[model samples]
Target: MEEKIKDVLDAYTFQTTRVCRGRGAFICDTDQGMKIVKAYHRSPQRLEFEQLVKYTIRDRGYYYVDQLLPNKEGQYLNNNKDGQMYTVRDWFEGRECDVKNAADVLAAVRQLAVLHMLMRRCDLSEDRVEQFSFQDTRQIFLKRRKELRAIYSYIRQKKQWNDFEKLYMQLYSDCMQEADAALSELNQFDFDGLRKKALDERTLCHGDFNYHQVILNRKYTAVVNFDKMHYDIQVKDLYQFLRKVLEKNNWDSSLGTMIMDTYLSVRTLSEEERRVLYAMLTFPEKFWKISNRYYNSRKSWISSVNYDKLCRFKKTEGQRQDFLNIFKYAFIF
Candidate 1:
């Protein structure tokens, strides 16, 4: 692996003293500074899209992104002998974000808001946006609801119940009931009307925004990995980060409120945006995800850890509801 990375590194003109793995990518000590060498398997078109995103962020006076480095051949990507694609970017000095810490969480969310303001200026066609439909509350809920029904049936047919299955059955009714109510509300909402308004003011979402992707030094120094960058309502990133932090904070309403307030402090959200966020927060995503992973895993036997996660989800259900209620009312039109 070192040799392969070294070979890729040779393509660059930088003088390197040492190279080692840094988290999910390779890092090197170059005369210029630290540089990250990462590889991906994306299509040429998607690569072009990300290339556009890189410059868009940089040009907007934001330098926190993983700026792609062109090799000696003047290409952003190096297709090696093994057919693997790699890219090198200047690395920032920092540590991964600590989601549990309120300050760190606030810093990351503020960075996201800044990124969104820059990305919203980019002019990408609507269809080019991956997961664009997810911005629509109706599509998001209806799709998850259908997937949940299938998983519910899959577990019901099993004669022998696993521990996960038992707890799943116990909570299935409540989860489904919540999902149904969300769907009903979504159905009555003017999805097309709100969606059109959102589209008129769309921006890019850090599709995989989380503590891991964020780097902190006093403040958030960088947000690495735009591999999941997509054209969507920017709140997608905020909603995702909120969900993750809320789970870690035991779904505490105060923490949830603090995070939301912190993010809005940097970027204001409109009523339509808040409504979409509300629907997303209200969805039974955790339950569906656990069931999805279990059913999707090729392994015949299920992992007990998944059951533990489901139990934790059940234990924290009340707190999540409380937080959601607070958010819903505070933002209610």
Candidate 2:
């Protein structure tokens, strides 16, 4: 390791023995055990809130969360020479959850349900309250719908179209209809009331609960990356995990049902929450993601991968719609 990194590690209580590079961080085998050291860019207050969430969950008996360990100075952050912030967090020695594995997918969602159950009614301090506020899905849906239209317009006006743009334009109408339908469904509900309920109940969600962030091992499945934890309707996590897994499975309705049953076995969802989840599933998130990527990046040269994603997305649309229809009829009804 570089001397600057060594200096930062020295501030920690543990003596670093082996240090290796990680995804945007360093993985260190320390005297205390395995720990990950990474540069943190969020505010100290957010860091504190994250730590608090982990500590609370751990105390509540979920020991598999990623924790931001305090340094020798009783602080979770340390500044390097160039003024970059760094943090040492406990690391899990395991592979990421395999979405293709049926058993792993079920287990991952089960654990998420457990985590959500424990994350309920968290008693936040005065300072943490402002930072740990509820997320309004209505505003989120509106913003995404607006972006979808904007991207469609941007792609339509292009003088010459790449393969990716050509495919996007071909499917833009259907995809935009999906977006509008989801937004319309959302408008039928008391969304603000649901957000208020989430706040009143102090429910917490793993804001980015995809399979990538889930870690699996022999004993227990560990969830890493609590950086995105926030106060929101917990079903948001379920929707994220379910969407990713279903997309990979060609939106298999049976598999989707099993995932929902596994989650519901642990924690139940309210009627409004269920409706919100349906709306979320209806949104053309993958289409929006591809469009956003195309619009934001340099358009002169486009990656073939974008074209590939659009093809796969197009191929899966029928199955996806079937899954959504079944979900609404079977679960939401």
CA lDDT, every prediction?
0.80, 0.87
Whole-model lDDT, model 2 = 0.87
Every model's TM-score = 0.92, 0.95
* Candidate 1, 64-161: lDDT as tens digits: 78788888988878866787888888887788888888888888888888787888757666666543434455677788888878877888898888
For residues 1-333, what per-residue lDDT tens digits would candidate 2 score against the true structure?
A: 756578689887777888888788899988888998888888888898888888889899889988888778898898888888898888988888888888999999999999999998888864565577755777777888798789878877878888898898899889878888888888897888888777777788988898988889998899888888888888889999999999998988889999999999999888888999999999999998888888888977899988899999999999999989888988878
Query: Clash pairs of candidate 1?
Result: none
- Candidate 2, residue 189: how far the Cα is off, in Å: 2.1
Report the number of backbone clashes for model 2: 0
In model 2, pairs of residues that clash are none
Clashes of each: 0, 0
Q: Candidate 1 — which residues are off by over 4 angstroms?
A: 125-137, 197-202, 298-300
